[model samples]
Target: MSNEAMQVRALRGRVVTPDHIIDDGAVVLSGSHIAWVGTADQAARAGFGDAVEQAQTAPEGGYLLPGLVDVHCHGGGGESFPNAETAEQAMVSVLEHRRFGTTSLVASCVTAAPDVLRARTRVLAGLCEDGELAGIHFEGPFVSVERCGAQDPTYIIDPDAALTRELIELGGGHVVTMTIAPEKPGITGDDGVNAALIEGGALPSFGHT
Candidate 1:
């Protein structure tokens, strides 16, 4: 038999499924999909044509929550997302977050030399071809220096179309959300640039506050 079918996982305690939760719920997986879920006491009684006996003996567990998705996390486990100097470094941070139940995430750049940002983010975007890196969060280069927090002031600048496009390409064309300061005026907060980013498939999130 295939390894997936041979293995069995029974998480019995507080089971939280996408729809609902069962107090003493249990989920039995015959493979990747959940084969069964119900109260532990009713597991064997409900009847499994061939696996009744085995299901009855599956161990009881603690809280079971399917992996998590953190859309706005800056970093975790001592790793800083904005500090990733290379694609590998960014991946390291991603893996760290995954190990701790963050099934999904976005990289938040803390501001740096445009060239460096492009180089690093492009690699990250390319890596996302494998579905690891979700997207890039540009939190600088267009942010108000007056509100700079954990970002390099030297790299801050007004947001523009050319630079924005360049960064998107650098990120392998995978810009998801960017934190921009729309109140900064001029090209720093141009609507055209925002529209281009949106059309490019990258979501824009305004944040000066």
Candidate 2:
């Protein structure tokens, strides 16, 4: 015989789902995911009176929102990802972002030497593997020097597919995204660098150009 299905629980608050917001509504949570979302009255009408058992309610004037994701944050709390002296320092930065309500974050590194970039990527990759970070974001070297805002223009270089692969490989498949100027040196139409990023399951974003 089949076992009893797990009971659904409700969280009463301002439920903000992907599509819409439900004020004074309830969110049904099944295990780790959102199972259902609607007004409390609607749930009761749908035969979920018992489902509201042991549910939580939000404080007055409070809202429940999905965890925020930041893709291009460089540093916070007196720590810089590109200048991270150690993994511990890097973690401090992550904590800072989290405190500001960033549930998911990618550690972005600025323009630097290949060796420096590789080292930083490896450190950030470890954080990703540990589930503390989303992934690493390389935001320089392949960007335009003229458009380089805070990045060190001296460290900027043309896009090199092999070098890109080196960084990606060093990250052990944790490179989530990299900003590239399609007009940067070594990046022609159908540049191999873009191909390498795509092949390694990393997104090639356009910026700084």
Candidate 3:
């Protein structure tokens, strides 16, 4: 094996996996990727003696798990994604979540004017391009006022397929989903919001009642 591949590090903790938890486990890292995972004793037996020797031990009772993915996040750290006008402003929220193990996030926007949506999309798309965001999610502008929840009722309107397409294009292919109301007109049919979202490589998240 190459010297680069031999450079490894390990961490000891209670590792959480999909099937079960390892009470006394070690995760070996080779470069940026996880090279191996098993019990602490197994790490040395599996030809990772050097890694185990240099392993960082987690606090007692601490659990090591995979980073989280938040699909519908507005903001954090006293910053709001919907109102963030600059990339730096938006990054404040991203970093806040990342500090707490949310490595992937989709910035969500509430009901707003078409112009506001356009502007926010532009800013968020830039973050997506830079790999700081996973995708974008629109929570309104085509939802029920009675069930709007936190959505701005003044900006709630009938679904517009054209507008959906426009926002998707603005997202530069990082538009993951848009919240919509099933009862709203232009939500179904061939040329409606649902069709437009699917065609644009996005999904319709039925919400707001």
Candidate 4:
């Protein structure tokens, strides 16, 4: 192995996985990727004995897990994605979440006028392009008023496939999902909002139900 690849590191802790948790586990990391994950003993058997020997032990009873993915976050650190007019402003929320282990986050926009939505999309899309944001999520503008909850009712409108397409284009392919009411018109069929989203490489998130 190259000297760089041989420079492996390990972390010993209660490793949490999808199926179960290992109380005495070790995670071997080679550079930026995880090289191995198993019980401490298994790590040694897997030829990671040196890594395990030099592993940094976690806090007593502490758990080690993967970074979180937050798909519906509006803002943090006193910054709201929906109101951010500049990329710097939106980055505040992104960095705040990243500081807490949320490595991937989707910036969500609330119900707003078409112009406002477009502006926010431009700002957020830039961050996505720069690898700061996972994607963009529009929370409203095509949802039911009765269940709008935090969405602004005044800007709510009937589902418009054309508008959806326009927003997706403005997102520069970084649009991940848009929250839409399933009961709304123009939400299904071939030329509907759902179809537009899917065609444009995005998804419809049923919300404000």
Give lDDT tens digits, candidate 2, residues 1-209.
22224556778888787888888787777666677777877887766666665568888987778778998888899989999968999989899989767999989998899989988988888888999888888987889888999889999987899999899999989898888998766664455778889988999898998
Residue-wise C-alpha lDDT for candidate 1, range 100-149, written one tens digit per residue: 77887777776778777777676667657778877777776777788777
Task: Name the 10 consecutive residues with the lowest summed lDDT in model 1.
Answer: 49-58
Instruction: TM-score for candidate 2, please give it.
Output: 0.83
The lDDT of each candidate is 0.70, 0.84, 0.93, 0.93
TM-score order, best first, reads 3, 4, 2, 1
Error of 1 at 140 (Å): 1.6
lDDT of 2 at 44: 75
- TM-score (C-alpha) between model 3 and the true structure: 0.92
Model 4 C-alpha RMSD vs. true structure (Å) is: 2.5
Alpha-carbon runs more than 4 Å astray in model 1: 1-10, 17-21, 28-36, 41-61, 186-191
Q: Predict model 2's lDDT versus the native.
A: 0.84
Q: TM-score per candidate, in order?
A: 0.76, 0.83, 0.92, 0.86
Candidate 2 regions off by >4 Å? 1-9, 18-20, 44-51, 189-191
- Candidate 4 ranges with C-alpha deviation above 4 Å: 1-7
| TM-score leader | 3
Q: Which 10 residues in a row give candidate 2 its minimum summed lDDT?
A: 1-10
Evaluation by TM-score, superior candidate among 1 and 4: 4
